[model samples]
Target: MPEHAEAGPSRTRPRAPRRKVYPTETFIDGRGDTLAIRTFAEEDTDLAGITRLCDEELSEPYNVYTFRYFLEDWPHLTFFVFPSADDPEPIATIICKLDMHRERTMRGYIGMLSVDKAWRRRSIARKLVELAMSRMELAGANEIVLETEFDNGPSLALYEAMGFVREKRVHRFYSNGKDAFRLIRPLAQHPLLSMAALRERQDAEQRSMAKEGGDNRSAVPPEIAVLLAGPLAPPTAAHADAMAELASLTIEPLPKPRPPPSYIM
Candidate 1:
């Protein structure tokens, strides 16, 4: 499913202000056209342009609510490319949001991306994505995720080139009954840190404790560890005998079957 939705109850604290001004960047494209990039501002009139770009290029039909969900909550996360410093109409735009996923980790979601056909092959999309990702990483996003049409080779290739991997395929995900591939890029987080050093330190501490006559029982029992290592193997002969003994002590054997009753004529 698309990441855009009603802000859930998991977000209880009030977020930062909605209309904070952000820095604007200017660059010259390959065609010698100067372009301006800036974060979406509440005062800007580029909403129509953004909607128009997506409506012109993408298949999904989005309403104003979808736009507001991403733009209003995370204005800084959305980037727009203008034709020049004075142009209010955006030629390209990318919308994104960051929120806690299942109350455990912060997840960043890219909801929409669109670029004008005239501006293709200029690497504008990549620049916008890189900007958004850097901001999200600074804001503590554990990972980023987005979905694109399964057959969109260009979209898939662009995302994969930026380190995203296909996580799964969702059937008939789009409004037009097109499949989508959910892609994910994991960022460096505490859970992914190497544990070898930690294990070695723990082993050394345990050895020191043993030398000092401290009781050092294994955290997990040997039998439980064996069971946890993998699927249980077939019961052994000794296990079968123990089970039989247990059954004999706890269960009563069935009585022999009695003959059927004769029916009276």
Candidate 2:
């Protein structure tokens, strides 16, 4: 997601016209499961859930938040929540802020990305980041930047895999003196980033069709064409079956060489 620079204690500037925002909603997963992704509206219930998730799963000491902080500032920030399919409660959250310092450059600041302990490694965080990037792009952001603890290997790797690069490292950047690394990526630099995003959505749709035990390759949406052109891991049973059906439709396939590894981040 985009990163926002820390605003100084200067006089408040005039606010820009607010864009039309839709209601928070869920995205259907590969198993016909619903994953809620919504804007942060200051409400008691949403605040409570966000607080619990951050306290429990994102216990980093450098974190900052307060009740008044949310009430007073959260409206200007972009927030999204991912609710668990089984429990019907929030499992993860991502916060983004728009940086107005640069023209036509929306700095995508990522803060408070946390997933429930029980929901780790299921691509929940990845999905959240993907959603954030999409939203930022839709908002006219040409690039995204974020910082993470230097020692956070999993996050570093995930961001790298998704096309971010280590732009700089600051010593003792956090209040507790932990070093931090700033990662940045241009949204248009890597074609694969968009492809991966499309694939994820396609995978979700394919899973929905498979749940009904019906073959529906014809239902493949045109918007998800990029995903159909590549191989994806954690494939649903229906995705595999659909691939098989597609394979039978073609003949005399040519041999191809393995592609090189990507090291964008």
Query: What ranges in model 1 sit over 4 Å off?
Result: 1-23, 28-33, 190-265
Candidate 2 stretches greater than 4 Å from native: 1-24, 28-33, 59-88, 102-104, 189-265
Model 1, 54-139: lDDT tens digits are: 89978898877677766666787988998876666788999888876655557788888898998888888888888888899888
Deviation from native of the Cα of residue 171 in model 2, angstroms: 1.1
Q: Tell me each candidate's RMSD, in Å, in order.
A: 21.3, 20.2
Residues 1-265 of candidate 2: C-alpha lDDT, one tens digit per residue: 2387786687988899664344666676544667766666655546666777877875353223443333344343445546532332577777664443333344555655788887677777888888788876665556787778899999999999998999999777665678889888787733456666667767777788789787755365532452355565456665666677767864442233132112112
Cα lDDT for residue 253, candidate 1: 25
Best by lDDT: 1
Q: What is the lDDT of residue 54 in candidate 2?
A: 76
Clashes of each: 0, 5
Clashing pairs for model 2 are 2-108, 2-109, 3-108, 3-109, 160-265
| TM-score per candidate | 0.64, 0.53
